[model samples]
Target: MSASRRTEARLLSHDEQQLVRTTHHPAIYEHGLDALHELRRRLRALRDRERTLLHHKMREIRGKAEPRGGSFPGLADHPGRRRQLFAQALKRVNAEASRLARMTARAVIGDGARRALALRKTGEQWLRPAPSPSPAPAPDPRPRPNRRGKSHIPGRQVGSVSQANRRAQAARDARPAPPA
Candidate 1:
């Protein structure tokens, strides 16, 4: 962080402290944390909204720039130029939104601002378009051996009782009941 940013952070922290002192309510810190989270959420939402709007404007520009059928033979390149202009506009808007989000994060988030920034950066990195997947490896030609021995049965029937146990239970039940 730059010196100016450090000073600004300190000032914000001081202000936050003052606010906490004035409130004097139990769970004030929890409330403050909630407020910080809400601020971050709102900023991110605003960025998303701005990005969507820019995308829409880009589409509109593309539509307008395109020449109609049987319109003009020499004007085909105009659409490309217009498209470039719209793309630049979109980029500028996205950049400004990012800057504003950074400022808001710096101002609203206190001690954990650095962590939050790092998390945001990682999140953005994660959201980037994924690279093409590698080719699947060839399956092994050799058949896999069963780990269990012959005694081990695959997919045993549910509630199946052993023959020996059944016989033993039957014998015990068949025995004459002892006089109570």
Candidate 2:
């Protein structure tokens, strides 16, 4: 079988796949049936939401457009104008909804492509061995004492200031005096 053909291909819910078969116009072509199904689901949900909102708006406009119980001749024509305006507004709403669907489809397709590219990059980076860091400069070899005298005698306490001073004075005394 060709690499593109899937022997074990599964349909997205047997009934829903047919409903979602159509590709979105002006959207990047999706390769997987699952992706197409998902896009269709999203578009349907968006359309449903828009429809609900538009229905509410139409109801509100209708409420505002009803003629009162007055017998005025001029008032009779007002409802007709209102109906015409409502129809125009409904058309606008539908146009906006279609635009939103197109934009959503485009965004979804783009994001999927970007994610795939990032995943490929990550896989490539992971496959390559990381460069070895340069060896750090060797640390100083001098011995360091912890708050004690330089002598390595165990258990010796050498933190006293007076004792250090006395040791220094005796060392100075033992040295021959500088020639006059």
Alpha-carbon TM-score of each model against the true structure:
0.24, 0.28
Q: Relative to the unseen true structure, what is the Cα RMSD of model 1? A: 27.8
| Candidate 1 local Cα displacement, residue 134, angstroms | 55
Candidate 1 residue lDDT tens string, 4-53: 33332333335433432322233322344345445345434534544554
Q: List the residue pairs that clash in candidate 2.
A: none
lDDT at 80, model 1: 38
Residue 155, model 1: lDDT of 56
- Pairs that clash in candidate 1: none
Worst 10 residues of 1 by lDDT: 1-10
Question: 1-180, model 2: which lDDT tens digit per residue?
Answer: 111112111312333223333332333243244554455455455445445444555665689544334453432233333333333333433444566668889999999999879989787553567767978644766756788656674445656767899999999999998999
